[model samples]
Target: MIHSCPLLRSLTLLLLMAGLTFSCQTRNSSDNTTEQTAALPPAPNFNADSAYAFVARQVAFGPRVPNSAAHVQTGNYLVETLKKYGFTVTEQPFTATTYDGKKLNARNIIGSYNPQASKRIMLASHWDSRPFADADSTQKNSPVPGANDGASGVGVLLEIARVLSQDSTKLSLGVDLVFFDAEDWGNSAVATDAYAGFCLGSQYWAANRHIPNYTAYFGVLLDMVGAKGATFPKEGYSTKNANEVVRNVWTTASQLGYSTYFIDQQGPSITDDHVPVNEIAKFPMIDIIHMQVNNLSQTFFKEWHTTEDDMDTIDPATLKAVGQTLIQVLYNEAQPVI
Candidate 1:
């Protein structure tokens, strides 16, 4: 999932479903003629239970605010988990000043697999809990539980990491999982400009990537993807910036029998993490974010920026739809060597 957003997080728009093209070639030998078609690689099964547990574990740590103890603990946990899953992990720590001039100690955690492969794919999600619940009428100063907005995306990616590690399938390309920090400290609700201070982690990463001169074939981002009856439309920016990536991913989801969830509609542009990746890093990325169809502007989840965004808002089915779709996308691109 890759797209751009405001309080909207990392995200995409869509190209037409028919844009994804495949071809088979024929070779005429002296003895016989043969046709070779595209191979269907087996995508590892995405475990909803495991993904759910990962979400729950993050919630138990309380809000992962940039300067909070929970933030530090969760960072350590993420690093250890990726390492356990055989990824070479890297932590990029940097300081950033927020919209209100508050200094944030932020770190972008990155996990790399098959570093030697030049062809690569990137997956990303923000990992910080919002410091304020501005969306709720009450508890305006309370921190959001972030079950969907932050933790849900990370949980799905973590499950993917586990699957990639456990499965014997040898991927034809490299994969990078990036958990961005300080993404939720923006002043969307309190400010006149919606995108004044959002996506700090992505902004930093886009400018200073973990690997110098690093590039990928494409990228996908996930945000607020584990809610009940979650709807994923083609984000406005994604449709325009990386329509091909959107077409391939959305088409894959539909092929996997998830057309109900991944709706083939246009969504509003968001100022999320994927914005910088596309605009600054020059990467073609798509955002697989959950959005409401009725609301054109700020179509985030109802519990977004609210304290009510807790474990109760998370649905295992939604997680399965998103996680499984991502796995399929990866495996579909894989071409094993003889």
Candidate 2:
């Protein structure tokens, strides 16, 4: 998440209930009427251990700071891991100038399943760790470990890729697992540009997609999703831009009995990678990020952007909830025509 004192201060608290009801609109030729119905599909088992291991591996590389050796190694590792899982991988490499006016080498790694299919689903997460632990008073200048913030989402996606590779027959729509870099480099506190630095890789990818004229049925971004007792309230921008997608995902989570983790409440909007994907790419996307109420940090998770955000803070149960919910959503999606 992007952090600015003003943005955090401007958070509007709103809450809404998330129920387990699936609605589908059916149009009738007579009188141009429409009807809605509900349906539930069986979901595959998501292994929490596997997802946990992936997060651990990323953290083991040390902080994935942009232009750092750890960042390059982590990027290569992600690309190779996806390829191992039978995904057609593509790397979008570019240079981005941070808010502090430092040019950094960034890459957006994409793993595609069923590359021939036109209808697709995009799952995204940032793979870069923050350069500074700004939120931690003890080590404000130290780099964040980013196990939960940066690696958690990617770890879940990697596990999803592994699960999907085991059985492509479960899904009809193609899938793209995107790992964006340089997402944590922005400082809303001092940046003069409204949209610069943060989410640099996503902004670039959205403006210049790997495939020409690329589009997706919908996209889901996972951010800071593996903290113990984490809660994911519906983010403001998601409701404003992709309310239907948000509903579908929340409903799916509820049906799977993960309502506690996937809270049915409206949350404050924050700057995230999905912002650029929605605005620049013009795609419907929702972020499944952790959120907290009445917190001094004004962050979703307790260890956000801090040195404490390490493997010790990771929880397998949280990973399982999110991973299982995503698997169900993908498997239940209708086949869109190519």
Candidate 3:
């Protein structure tokens, strides 16, 4: 989740639902065709249990806050694991100044497959958990376990890397899996400048990409995706900045029969890593983040930024829903040779 410190006094709340409807109508007319009924491709076998275990493995490493031993060890684990999965792993180590003037040693890990292919897709998620559970009433100053928030998305991506390694022929396009650090090291709720402290690793990567002049067809960022019961509505910034990308992901989710988890509703604008990717990297990027419409909390999942976001809340089914959808999307993009 991105932070918005001191509140933007001039920013207006953009009602995304209405904007999506209009955009859909325009897209449908321009396409002028019903949804294609291509034979459903073979199901990409994404194992939920394996993904769950990956999440658990990260939690066992303790809180991966930046500048800590746990953070360094976990970063190494990610690099080695991806290398074992047949990816050409690259690590970008940099120092970032946090909102409160703390310099953090952050690493952005990138794993590339089929680097020769010109058509590429990027998938990313932040690996560092927030240092302070500022949102939790009882443990306002304590660090969150971040099982669902931090580890979940990385787990799914790691599992995807594993599958890609087992069957290289399954992927035709180049794929890059990026694990960004220091995303959650941001200002507290009481801070004067919120967004200033967040997404440090991504901000750095956007400015200095792993591969010089690197470009992707599109990118997707996953966050809070392993909650027991999660809903992914179209984020406002995604719709405004990358409407086509959002449509593609939502359509793929629907075709995979995961429509219940990927609802058609529009969520509020979020200040996630995708924002910098879209604005700076110039990639049309979308965010698959958990949001609850009926819940009283408007921003994110229930245990967001709380100590309760531990391993107990990491549900395998939710991981499966997200991982399978991502696999299906990638497979759909794979063009078979004539």
What is candidate 3's TM-score against the reference? 0.86
lDDT of 1 by residue, 1-338 (tens): 44444654432322322233211222233113211112345678999999999999999999999999999999999999999999999999999789888999999999998888999999999999999898889899999889999999999999999999988867878999999999888886464444568899998999999999898999999999999999999998899999999998988787677888999999888889898999899989889899999875557888888999999999999999999989988988886557
Which one wins on lDDT? 1
Q: Write the per-residue lDDT of candidate 3 for residues 134-197, one digit (tens) a residue.
A: 8899888888889988899999999999988887455779999999888997774544553557
Better of 1 and 2 by lDDT: 1
- Give the Cα-based TM-score of candidate 1 against the true structure: 0.86
Indicate the worst ten consecutive residues by lDDT in candidate 1. 30-39
* Stretches of model 1 off by over 4 angstroms after superposition: 1-39, 189-194, 295-298, 336-338
Query: Any runs in candidate 3 off by more than 4 Å, and if so which?
Result: 1-38, 188-194, 336-338
Error of model 3, residue 187, in angstroms: 2.1
| Residue 237 C-alpha lDDT in model 3 | 92
lDDT of 1 at 301: 83
Better of 1 and 3 by lDDT: 1
lDDT of 3 at 338: 56
After TM-score superposition, the amount by which residue 95's alpha carbon in candidate 1 deviates from its true location, in angstroms, is: 0.2
TM per prediction = 0.86, 0.86, 0.86
